[model samples]
Target chain A: MNVVLLDPSEVRADGGASLDGRRAEHVAKVLGKAPGDALAVGVRGGKLGSAQVVSSTKQALELEACVFEREPAPKRPITLVLALPRPPVFRRLLQHVTALGIERIVLLHTRRVEKSYWMSPSLEPAAIDTQLQLGLEQAVDTVAPDIERARGFKAFAEDRLPELAAGARVLVAHPGPFGPCPVDVPGPVVLLVGPEGGFIPYEIERLTEAGAQGVSLGPRILRVETATLALLGRLGG
Target chain B: MNVVLLDPSEVRADGGASLDGRRAEHVAKVLGKAPGDALAVGVRGGKLGSAQVVSSTKQALELEACVFEREPAPKRPITLVLALPRPPVFRRLLQHVTALGIERIVLLHTRRVEKSYWMSPSLEPAAIDTQLQLGLEQAVDTVAPDIERARGFKAFAEDRLPELAAGARVLVAHPGPFGPCPVDVPGPVVLLVGPEGGFIPYEIERLTEAGAQGVSLGPRILRVETATLALLGRLGG
Candidate 1:
């Protein structure tokens, strides 16, 4: 982890904090940090800062008051609408998009998305928090992305997507004879990416009717996580 | 796997072939192909085609002569120059770049690159081929990316990079003050990316002196794989 993240609740009014479990283990084993060593630290949904190790032990790592450095990195103006992938793929994409500083995520359901994927335990709140936290840590950012689920394509397209994407340019990442994906878009965007085999024609049509323009990233299909990062990267102005 | 890839040697003079082991297991268990089923197939570094399963058994899966359908997808006009990442990261990057149709790769040794990464089994020719094959299958493309290793940054920057990147725009992905990465360049490019903590100031200076213009993907620090895909996606025309 690039930055040590502590939940707001963990920080005492005196600014002292104690960390155990994974964070402690990572600080001790991976970082080989000792007491008095200053490390980059950030509060959950707070500011970036530095924390000096007060004490280190097998059970926990203690830190003194944080010296706030600066505000979190600016958030990307992108709302990712992705068809739910297999659990393993979902885990990686969550961390990647989060690290890229995405503003929001909508796990969508489409015809090509396997029904079994939604049953995965990775969709649980705890599991998602763990992944997004990893992303925030990787980027040294303090803001956590907001995630929502859209269980049905038609319902999401007709009811929720249009409103959620009302002021944003909505684009779907599709293959075949579509216009190329936009580059370095400076404004807010709602980008819809499909599952493994891609959204069926009917799903694409519905998304198109919902004000999303179908765009291609070229002929070679990329995995979900790769595509998400690529799209985000392309739109990063 | 999107397409079953066969080494050129696997195709007999008459174009018929038999496959066993991993590919057979995949066709049998994952794809559930039976005798007389036609499946998409491609020749390594060659063409895309279809193979009809003539026979199926526990030991081997036999196929009739392939009817070549088309040439492989056009290669991406880009070559990646990256610092050697950890082995696990290397594996994913190999597959990702291959799926994105990178024309070539040069894994360089830089100040931040851990020397231990050179000894990884993932760097072995066979192991690298396996990952690249997976990428080719995933993208339904037949060209396998050519990979090279540059043991020292200086040697690579002076002795080889100038020549290899001749006639191509060479841009290095760095985090600090630099111009934004280019998008949709309709020409060949040699993109350089750094290892984990990123290239030190001296290393970046050397790369800058070597015809590489340092470019930023903005403020959010992306992992090596994410940065690589984003750069590639941004440059995809």
Candidate 2:
């Protein structure tokens, strides 16, 4: 773990706080923390602090944490408008985007998206949260990306695209004949990535008309998850 | 497996050819091939063929094969020069590049590359070959990418690059002040990507002087593997 993240509710009534269960196990085994070891800790939506381990056991550990400074927000402002992918890929994509500290994510539906993907057990809120948490941990950041779901491309383009694109640089990833995607564009960007088969011509037209510029990643086709991570990495860099 | 790839020896063999061990297990269990099932197969340097399963068992299987036609070479010619990554990531990157039908891969050494990484057990030739085979199978291509090791950057850039870039477009991926990476660039390309911390300024300068154009995937810093795949996807597309 890059940084240890704690939930606000985890703090005990006393000044001393105990980390139990998986977190405790991670600390004891993976981190190999002993009594009096200083651990980097952050409270969700709160400030970061150095926690002094007071006692340790196989199942739980206690720490004395002092409130410190708040973690900084992400450097770049990024919002992803992605068509939902298969469950396994979605899980990896979520963690990767989170690690890169993206500001927001909008999971939209497209014609090519399989209906069964939406109903996957992996899409559960708790599971999604876990993936985001992993991303935050990887980047040593405290902010969690805001994730929203959209049911249809038409509705999202007609209703939500205007609002989302009002002040952001919008780019849509399609496999057609478009110029190279620009690197290091200034200001916030709203990136749209289609499902496996890619955005249909009509969908591309609608997004383009709604202020999204069609961009190409290159010639060879990439899997949905690979494309998402590549776009995020390229755009975020 | 998207395609079945066989070594040159396997192809030149006469009747009663046996596929033992893992290949046998995959054919019998995973692919559910029984006696007389027709399977698409390709010999490493020979021809694509349709093979009929003669006998099947968990541990071994035999096939009667007939040569058909050679699998065509990949359309876009691209070579990847990457600073080796961590073991797991390196394995995945190999498969990914293979899936995209890259022609060559040169694993180079860079300052940021951990010395311990070179000693990784995963770097064994057998292990590397397995990963490459997996990629070849996924792309349904018969040609195997030539995998080579470059000891150092200066030597490779000064001695080897001239011949490597004889008539190819050479692009170096850097997250600096470069414009978007070009898509649909015709002709052969030698894409260079740095390790985790990226190539040092001097390295970038040297590469640029050596006829490599600096290209950016955008502002976001991507992991080495991600950057490689992204560039391949965009360039190949």
| Per-residue lDDT over A1-237 for candidate 2, one digit per residue giving the tens place of the 0 to 100 score | 756788888776564677888678888887899988998777776666778888777699888854547654544588899999999879878877776667899999998899999999888999999988777765567778899999877899999988999888899988768876766556889999998778888888899899999887555455666667656645644
RMSD of 1: 1.8
CA lDDT of B112 in candidate 1?
88
Candidate 1's residue-wise lDDT over B44-136, tens digit each?
888899989988766788998787779987998788998999998899999999998999999999988989899999999999999999999
lDDT of model 1 at position A63: 95
lDDT of candidate 2 over B65-113, digit per residue (tens):
6555765455457788998898988988888787667788899998888
**Candidate 1 Cα deviation (angstroms), residue A165:** 1.7
| Candidate 1 i-RMS | 1.3
- Poorly placed runs, candidate 1 (over 4 Å): B57-59
lDDT, model 2, position A94: 86
lDDT of 2 at B226: 55
Evaluated at residue B227, the lDDT of candidate 1 is 88
Q: Give fnat of each prediction, in order.
A: 0.87, 0.12
Per-candidate RMSD, Å: 1.8, 6.8
